[model samples]
Target: MDTSTGATVAHRSWRSRRLDPERSLGLRLTLTVVAAFLVLVPFTLLALLVLGAWPPLLRLDASIAGSFHGYARDHPAWVGLMTVWTHVCGPGPLRVAAVVVVVWLVRRGAPRLAVWVVVTMVAGGLLGALLKLLVGRDRPDLLDPVARAAGYSFPSGHALNATLAAGVLLLVFLPFVRYSGRARVALWTAALLVTVVTGLSRIALGVHWTSDVVGGWVLGVAVVASTSAAFTTWRSGSGRPSAHPLREGVEPELADQRPEGGRA
Candidate 1:
């Protein structure tokens, strides 16, 4: 009995070491990808800025807005959905929702995720603000069939906030969903489609230039990638056990033992 117990202990110890390998590797890969994206986005943006592409992009945005305005004029029912989306993407309620999610994460899950949530929120807002100020691009003067308040409109706040909220929420929720191999692909495809439509809505509403929407997208992606890296690294280093209870329960068995006869 004593010998068998000793063997089990040794096996478990070895398995634990083998399973983790290096906790930092996932974090490192995430950081590397984010860094590559960051380097690429700005260079592309600079080229567009230098080539004076803003005029055409703005015109495109205006045309989209005009199209939507015409549609709304023709179909009054469509106005309701647009209003709902505008409200959902607005600053006040979205910020409150972000705070609530962060608090929930800090209390129930790893605090690292919560911290990243907050950081991403702040970074998204600040980056959008700075870009808008620096770009100083004018909002569309063309009359919208549906009137909106006047503002400086490079890097649309609606697009930025919507993308930030949706992207971060997806990051937080993805780990929780139990997706089969095929389901995961479908899930990601749907998520991409929703994100694209939401961004386009801002341009369609005459609230942002096309370049503004593109910049918002770039910033949102950067924030999600970088925050995911930082959070993963922090959680791995803490060694406080997974905050995910289900994961904690299964990890020991899976990580510490191999299937007999190659059957799971």
Candidate 2:
């Protein structure tokens, strides 16, 4: 072959390999970096606002807190419900639930999936706590408060942990419902409801500002996305078939493995 033609063929082959998402670690790393940038940028901006005590955000936080506190003070029933919801979905309870899930996964012979759950939750929880300490923002101080909590509250731990739990549960169960459109929709809807309401419960109880909840939500999402991307990259490197989390769950192979109970 002519030198020019040989060069042309090599160039095309190189371009094709780079563009192949399944085999290209470079492409995956680039995507992971972009996703982290997108998630962290807003979170950092929010943290800055909190640290600076920006007047506008403070005003917004006050306005929402006042409104929610006003209603909470009047309706003893509503406050009661929120208090229950917050504790049930709080960081402590969620962490316990995650431990149970990890045990379940291990018993089912999915140790890797179990580790992912533990790592995702532990990393998110620690990051949230670290940010809270660094930000050193206080809880909403309201007269006649209906509910009380003790912590540095820039990012609500309840919100952060709940978001992590919701995301983990949805991904773990997605494979079971992958073939049923309605089941998939229900799973997503449930996750959204839990994550949203848990955060809202914190605000409604006058324990956290809206911005704190937002920061937690954003950070939680970033953790999940970052870890999921890492898991995907690992799967690709390990010769596993590429599967979308939303469509096939983080561990699609789990669907084929019966729980230990079913084996005997």
Candidate 3:
């Protein structure tokens, strides 16, 4: 009887500690890191490994890549269209977009978010570049290539860049979405569609293996999700006092973000 009573008490105590907002906030961040960086990143790499180093999978990858290239060859018009989004969501464009967004955020009294945006975009791009070099996979070859790209190719840069650009923009603007109706839903849907199309365009253009695009998506989502987790932790940990529209408010994030914050 005493043992049973002790077990129940311990369980409740543990639950209380785990559910504490302060600790729970950190816990959520940890989980996000595990899921994105540890799990998904590794899985993506392993798939690339199989696709790159394994003979059987290599044959399959080549077949699909060739088929995609052939389709692009037959449809020149589509190639032009795909190129439009690919260029818009490419590394250069994404960097420019990041700078523009950050400048706007800073001007709008959201300096913290501006900093976060820069860090996420720059850091994510650097990480993706490192992974591509480490993997050192080659791009698809064609006798009559529809388009040309230069770089190591285990993970598609276009796909990764597109996703990060779309994702970061979506999240940074989410706080200001101002409504829960079709406007918000449509915004998200459009972002998602653009990301997907950009990734597929790389495949169709004969520049990347299907696995490469999949890996890019995984890596991109991981980077964005990790950034989001950090933001959430900051908000829940040091969030400031505010009267929310619903009378329930998440904290305002870093002390530096507060209007009268001691630290900038």
Candidate 4:
């Protein structure tokens, strides 16, 4: 949204041209479909597992957990690291981080994106909680659990919290990262790495079946995708397509057309 070069129509061309309602609607529908699939597929899988509809997937979960359990036995340092990761990626820490992120977004004048972040986190939490209650799957039973976690284990809370936070943050910041393509990709990669590591940590700890972590990922993708679509819709309507990062030297004229706080 830089405006230093006088008139700067070209600078704003990308946003203006790309914000077409038809294109936006198409993107929104695509995202919604993807989200719906992510959500429903995982829920159906959980139902099947709960009802013993597919005994093989349960055996596969056990086999994968067994592999992780075997690997963890020889890697004390890895076990320690995963334990630390579990606590750090737990719901409590993720919620605190989400609050910090939302405040940062609000301060950067992208309150709409802030709302997206909050809503995604909340949705992920609620969905994970509900799935756990409905499935009532048990945790992995190992002779020596490297780490113990309580409650139902159909969806790994650690994995869901990490995915929701990382996924939403990535989506929320993507549109504003126009200047640094490498940085954008690197950020996305880092988010993916953290999410995967968190899921793996649960398995290594012997606290969750492998399917639980997978379910967490599937459910988290749904919530994050939904939030992404909502955020883009808000950005298209609010005219602050580049409100995030706050690095654009000059704001666009459309930004002036936005509300006083740079929000919708």
Candidate 5:
């Protein structure tokens, strides 16, 4: 009888400690941000579509597409280079690489980072595909040295993949990598530049409208932000151990500290 009473008391005590509110603010905040982002992004995109904003957007797309079309028509060598580069940076291969990297991170015990990467990729890819289907915008039809692509082109996949990849990489490395501030800045700069160039490549290849690329970038950024917030919450709730050795053996004083590193 005494043993049973003692066990019940201990269980209640553990529950109280686990549910302590002060340590969970970060988690609450992160979840709130994620919820807000999920609501806002789709609404904004729908508003833009419903307001008939595509005409002006498409005109801008054509102007940018025209320059690439002209350049590709005149410079066969440059066109060939761009064609190859575009294929190299296309959604299929980049997404595969992203998956491999994410799996590697998970195996390395950075499961939170891995989850964020995979979530961002899947969310961005699905969202982009849905938007493309709904918009159903035609690609620029013009003289091009490179082979033409066919599909309902809105929200360029290249741009989506580039932005998501850059965003995921930055999130994964920034908090974890032991790098100088200048190096971190340089790394981010390079990532941003790569993302921009990837988006531009779609326009250059005459495979996507300018609006498509811009929309993709916007969606990608939103996905990154929202997914990061959700990941932060999940990591917090799971009671994972600290990666920092100095913090080893210290009982988690906050919600962000999870036992077993939040592994399922």
Candidate 6:
């Protein structure tokens, strides 16, 4: 009986320690590092394969690109729709949207959050550009092409920007959606939909290989995870409440403001 009582007490103690925000910060940061590594390693391997022109990857890229082009030729309407989706959700427009969000955040008195948004998007964009240049991969060469994009194609710019934009906006508005509810579900669904569809639009238009889209996704995710970890560290050091960005969003205080927060 005594042993049973002691075991119960120890379990409760351990659970409490795990729940302690101050104690868990290190673990959270470690997990972020591991996640970033997992994301980057795959991207690096893909870039290497592109550079070396690995046969298996090249065969796969050609097969997929050819199939997509075949379908694109038959379906003019679908091709047109994909073209519009690609352009509307492309990097340029998404960056503009991110800029608008930044302005909104600053006006709402969350300059830090605004800065985080800018840094995340800009850094992701610049990194994507750098990787594209370094990889120096060419776009899928399709005869009777349904769409066209001019750039190195190891990582689709549209995919990277859409992913970064989705991640930034999702984190920004997550708090406002109350963490859990239909609103939260809708926000996540929209972000995911935009990210995925933008990537697919690139493939469907016969402009990017499957590997290019995948690389973009991996790199974009790495950037977001890295920046989010840095922001969380800053919050902890500044004596803010513990942030579980995956759960409560990056800046919960954004949604917890009073009327005065909106005033000059």
Best by TM-score: 2
lDDT of 6 by residue, 164-234 (tens): 99999998989988746989899999999999999999999988999999888888888998898889878
The local distance difference test score of model 1 is 0.62
Q: By TM-score, how accurate is candidate 4?
A: 0.77
For candidate 5, the per-residue lDDT at 132 reads 75
Give RMSD to native, each candidate: 11.8, 3.0, 5.4, 10.5, 9.3, 5.8
What's the CA error at residue 157 for candidate 6, in Å? 0.6
How does model 1 score by TM-score?
0.68
Candidate 2 wrongly placed segments (more than 4 Å): 1-19, 260-264
Per-residue accuracy of model 4 over 1-264 as CA lDDT, tens digit each: 456754576756654554545566445455556657767786676667755747788788889888989889999998999899888877898789889978876676667667777888888899889878987888887988777888999788888888888876665555545468787778778789879998988988899888788878877877776666565555555654533322321122322244346655
Runs of candidate 5 exceeding 4 Å displacement: 1-54, 176-178, 238-264
* Cα misplacement distance, residue 53 of candidate 3 (Å): 1.7
The lDDT-based order of candidates, best leading, equals: 2, 6, 4, 3, 5, 1
lDDT of 3 by residue, 153-176 (tens): 867888888888887777765544
Better by TM-score, candidate 6 or 1: 6
Model 5 Cα lDDT, one tens digit per residue, 1-61: 6999999999976655546565564535644575667756774774376347657655676
How far does residue 114 in candidate 5 sit from its true spot (Å)? 2.1
lDDT of 2 by residue, 175-243 (tens): 999999999999999999989999999999999999999999999999998888888778877888776
Cα error, residue 251 of model 6, in Å, equals 0.7
- Best-fitting candidate, scored by lDDT: 2
Tell how far residue 133 is off in model 4, in angstroms. Answer: 0.6
Give the per-residue lDDT digits (tens) of candidate 1, residues 1-264.
Answer: 699999999998665554444544454555547675874577357436724756665567667767766776676666666666667667667779889888766555346566777888898788778877776777666564454646677666766676677767666655444335565455566556555766776665656556666767776666665665555545555664433312221122223333233433
TM-score of 3: 0.80
Misplaced by over 4 Å in model 4 are: 1-31, 237-264
Candidate-wise lDDT, in order: 0.62, 0.90, 0.73, 0.73, 0.68, 0.86
Q: Which scores better on TM-score, 2 or 5? A: 2
- Candidate 4: 10-residue stretch with minimal lDDT: 245-254
- True-vs-predicted CA distance for residue 192, candidate 3, Å: 0.9
